[model samples]
Target: MNGHFPWLTVMAAVPFAGALAVAVLPAAKRTLAKNLALLVTLVELVLAIIVTVKFSPDGDRFQMTESYAWIKSFGVHWSLGVDGIGVVLILLTAVLMPILILASWHDADGPQVRMDGTAGESAAPRSTHAFFALMLAVEAMVVVSFAATDVFVFYIFFEAMLIPMYFLIGGFGGAQRSYAAVKFLLYNLLGGLVMLAAVVGLYVTTADHDLAGPGQGTFDLARIAQAVSTGELHISPGAEKAMFLGFMFAFAIKAPLWPFHTWLPDTMTEATPGVAVLVTAMVDKVGTFAMLRFCLELFPNASKTFAPLVITLAVIGIIYGALLAVGQTDIKRLIAYTSISHFGFIIMGIFALTSQGHSGATLYMVNHGFSTAALLLIAGFMITRRGSKTIADFGGVQKVAPVLAGTFLVAGLATLSLPGLAPFVSEFLVLVGTFSRYQAAGIVATVGIILAALYVLVLYQRTMTGPVKAGVEKMRDLNVRELVVVAPLLALLLVLGVYPKPILDVVNPAVDDTLSQVEKTDPKPAHPIQAPVEQAAAVTPLGGNK
Candidate 1:
């Protein structure tokens, strides 16, 4: 890599470059395209790891920053950087891309099965190279979304990703993919439009500040955060509330929480497993990420004012998502609902406004991405073998495919927040953090956790523990390659569950800095949220997982 050139920019460009390569290659050279795509993803992952290692965790400021002039007249420029939060998310995006590629290998080896009631009829693999290429392209955009420092630049990458993801789901998904793709686009674009208005509002405000202050107007978030910290920019509670809702609506729809969450089940059920992984695990996190990066940091007073409502909604989502999941017969749809429920917990932690709460939220984002990826990948593998995503279509799979059953069990247990799994630590932190702030919400969220155990365990029993369904008795164990693909994810789930400190050490400083900024601007009232005795006692020992 060139020392002066921006490595992250190179990471973004490499996938598009690969996509071009894939497009130009002869159709007969599909294998070549596949290899090239894998190489590109591997390179991207390496770049992310390099960025992580090089990041200065000691400094809460953005690292490996690149800035340049773009639209000088509007005071907008291309700027990108990463702090600890960005590092893990960027790395998570990188990690999933390769796993996705590996998950698709079996699909590439075979053909699409026609739905003419034929069980094993084969058609040519569904343009496996193109699928991988599009996935990499989406990964690149995800990286950009996480790394961009300027609001305009962030908006560009944030919105541009839909183009590729839309096609990926629509072109390569199962039945109803087209409808899912359109729904996804409409809902996200609606949110984006609102956020775009906010971005414009921000620019206007910045200009006004520049006229009165010593420096020029800028969209640099660091400058904006500093301005807020020093009271250079004063947004009234009313204006702050509106801006907060604008950003909140956008992220909520993306996070697909509660009322804004109708699109998720449809998209997940219809899209291919690989695409679903990104939609749920990676892209969706951007919404929560934005809430933390922009909503809380930029409009702390509004967040505090809105905290009670947000926590109430979050609790409702937790219960509602779980109930919906339990009612769903479609396996994919069930998982999608479970995600909504889990995300509710994440948002609750964020709005709880405690240090551990934020830490839990951050860790939840990371753990949820990995754990969800593992489940979706395995789900894809099962669907490919059994040719159905309905829970009724599976039974006693452990007898027929022990290895597949094992992976599913591991993923499902993680989903249930089993102790010593990645989610367990994060979820515990969230509840503890929430209990510290809002005892009632925390206690209710714990009920959601218990429900999680129900749905997940029931799902596992229904799918893997009964007598093998008539059509499923002959299903084969995972192939060598599939095992290789899932092994790393499974290992990490256990490793991080047991020892999350390394990741936390890096994440805590940035989280602390962000909360500190919020406090200085919107000082905590003398009376913080009061917790019930039992709930307070429950979370006291954890100390917010810090």
Candidate 2:
């Protein structure tokens, strides 16, 4: 927490070190690489916990902040900090990494089963070393992206995440791995390019100001936001809105809103379970997070102008994703579509522009990660065992693997936001907050809950219930190691469901700060009026009172 310790820098570096080590290790030392990566992630998790403890609930300023001049000529600095929301997300990034690594124990080092039922014949047999190394690299980039306080720094960290993940899909994914990876890469790259233009525009605008004087501009996010919040910085309204759209366009693509979401299912379907969980559950969150941090905070006026369109899209995504999920035969692809549906809810919560909605969206991020992890990992277990990822390939799995079926049921229930589960609390908050502002959108999004139930339960019933399928009679239940792997995630889902106050305490303050930054409030209802009979009659100018 202290500047003296530089924990933020250290935390980000640990995974990089692990990745470099794994990258250099001999091909035979796959165990060493995996173990080292695990050790590094464990350490990162501890540091994330410590960082969380250091953050005060009442504080609005970024905590554990560090700053130093890095590129002096460009006016860029190495700056990082964690607000309550950032810390929780950083914790999520760290927590999910180890769980993913553990779950990928056997899968990472083996050939992935493609859509056609053939094991991928990559240049190498299963290479755990490369897999773990890339995983660690992805973790490092994600951490910095969450913590970055410099605009250019944040953008760089933001785009840097794509490298390790690109290889993760292309090198160790399904039969169509290369295509999926290319699609994911190209989409993200386009978003980044637009954002880069915006970043450059911001610098130029800042430099032209009298305060900046001459040619000195800065890429400090804090300073820029502060300038905008006060009356000092003045870009033309048109320019500001344009810049806002430029940045928003990037996040929208990243958020994979509506038509932008096509690449996600393909990429997720082609990815391994670990990769899918990392990208969809954790990494994709950056989109929403940046929208809150950058789009709303830096462009309050533009956010107001675009709120209606964004909410409309969020509603569309909610329904579209759910309907697609319902029709999916591929289980992994189904998981991807389900996420798109859930993300709609998350986006709606954010733009709802209510404190309750903002806080709920934040909590939804954490809850969705845990829920998705359970679904993906457990489903992966079944697919790996059955030699297929198709839902039709599974039936009556509970008859053979009762424990697995039961766990899947719990995960499915959580996904649908069943009462007494973590997602229910967050999803409820999102709905309540959204309804507080936009009644019609809230009502429409509510239908997604029912669609969610139908998809989740139907998937469960089709795959886990009924008579045992011909080749699946001998499918094994979750073993002891598997239980160990999932127990923590399940426990979290339950504990947070019952006791979300601890997280809310942290998230609420950040939400309040965000609402303050945007400076918008829910519309007030008109007061009902009652008048004397004579006064009422006088008011009826058009016709005489009966």
Candidate 3:
């Protein structure tokens, strides 16, 4: 599959082509545009599944590889490949795109209705074609980002994605959409600028040191990572640290860790739920994923040097996000804060630098995407019904709409990482892995779990448990279309929660490879387990000797 077929290229290109086609469709063909976009995503999803099926976890570190010389002068190539991490994330993106399209079916149509159920005549019209087309464009860019083995290629799309997303937020969002969209764009653009400097610095360093070969340089991630691993490329500690900071600053803001996280709540608060899902669940994942692929692999020594500081920041984010979530009066804002907390766990696991940690972090990324989608999309539906995003606007939702309230409860419980839910397995693995080496940090991170319970349960109680609010009296249950969007997500949560081995099988080998690249090994247990024969022999011998 490496060169026989252009799987990765096709996967990215289909949606890009679809986006073009959808964007150009006549405004009169709005439904056709939506159908065409959904069809394209479904086709993309099928291709992704084929790639996943063909992927051999035990085979090469990067499979389905495709490379062609794109810019000879710059020593750049259009290279695409996927390790286990990329495979799962790509699949996650493919799965979510269609669901989001369906979830946002009517989101871009006309102006929003007022809380009194009156249509707002003053609101601006939204273009459905642009909305769906922008979403498809985002999918294409994200797929490319995941599969790109050329650092230059990756950076190009990484920054390019912000364009479509800016429009998606500002064009199809709420009252403060313009403000939120600007803030999101500015924050990420600043991060991208910083990353561009580091990208250039890396290319220069490779050229100066001849990391590729004598009198040559390369921007291929695999080649450079191999050079670093084998000691063929020796970057000075100071230069590596500086480059690491440059790359890290960008990803941190993308990951939205603690202080850098200010833009997210505002962004999600204003964006349509589908756009919110795209930003938080799928788009933001690129940041954390880059940390694993770029930061750790490309700068292993710097990774080791800065692991503690990174872990500390992650722990703080966990606590900070959870605490804010507990206090949020706005439903969307609350979910946004919880995502910040979840990302903290993901980042902490990545920096923990062990097999379990890495594996859990990767799995957590996938699980969080689905869980967040389920919760946020459902909340969006509720908000549409009540014409409000305030937590206090609805009460006794379960009494009026049992199915909706039930699903919301399940999604909320998953958010709290309750036992027997999708997030629980990933979160547990993260703690176990982090506790193995960074005990104090792990211990503090658990406070997030307690806080998560407080927020999730309190939210459920306030909205769904008490007597019905005045407006919620006639609230409807999950409609067929809405159920189509949510059922799969919830099913995945349940399936993965009890049996995470399938995903683990795919990610574990990659995690091991990453640990090897960084020269990390899991910490040994304090008390080793003895073989049964040894234990029996010791017990009998002790009795006889006594």
TM values, all candidates: 0.91, 0.94, 0.97
lDDT of 3: 0.93
Q: Number of the top candidate by lDDT?
A: 3
Show where candidate 3 strays beyond 4 Å: 112-122, 530-546
How many angstroms is residue 49 displaced in model 1 relative to the true structure, after the best TM-score fit? 1.2
Per-residue alpha-carbon lDDT of candidate 2 for residues 1-546, written as tens digits (9 for 90 to 100): 244778789889999998999889998887888788888899999999999898898875688888988898888889998888888999989889888988887767666555454765653476788889999999998889889988899999889988989999988888898999999999999989998998889898888874345778888877878788886777788988888988988888787788789889999998889899999877898998898888888788888788888999999999999999999999999999999999999999999999888989999999999999998999988998997888888899998898999999999899999999999999999999899888999999999999999999999999998888887998999988688778888888999899999999998887887788788875565564555885776575666554
Overlapping backbone residue pairs in candidate 1 total: 1
Model 1 bad stretches (over 4 Å): 1-5, 106-126, 211-216, 520-546
lDDT of the candidates, in the order given: 0.84, 0.88, 0.93
Q: Model 2: residues >4 Å from true position, as ranges?
A: 1-3, 111-123, 210-214, 525-546
Better of 1 and 2 by lDDT: 2
Looking at model 3, which ten-residue stretch has the lowest summed lDDT?
Answer: 111-120
Cand. 1 TM to true fold: 0.91
Best by TM-score: 3
lDDT of 2: 0.88
lDDT of 1 by residue, 1-546 (tens): 224659778777888787778777777787788788888888888988888888878974788888888888777767888888888898888888888877775454456534342325454456766777777778888888888888888888888888888987776766677788899999999999998888877777777778324455678888888888889888777777888888888889988777899989989887878789989988999888988898888888888889889889889999999988888899899999999999999999888888788889999999998898898888888888897888999999999999999999999899989999999999998998888768899998898888898998898999999788988988988888788889989998999899999888888888888888778322355577767885676664654662
**Which pairs clash in the backbone of model 1?**
111-123
- TM-score winner between candidates 2 and 3: 3
The sequence of per-residue lDDT tens digits that candidate 3 reaches over residues 1-546 is 354889999999999999999999988898999999999999999999999999899999999899999998788999999999999999999999899999999998986533333556775567889999999999999999999999999999999999999999888787788888899999999999999999998998888877666766889999999889999788999999999999999999998776789999999998999999999998999999999999999999999999999999999999999999999999999999999999999999999998889999999999999999999999999999998889998899999999999999999999999999999999999998999999999999999999999999999999999999989999888899999999999999999999999899999888998889999999988999998988887684544763
Q: Ten consecutive residues with minimal summed lDDT in candidate 2?
A: 115-124
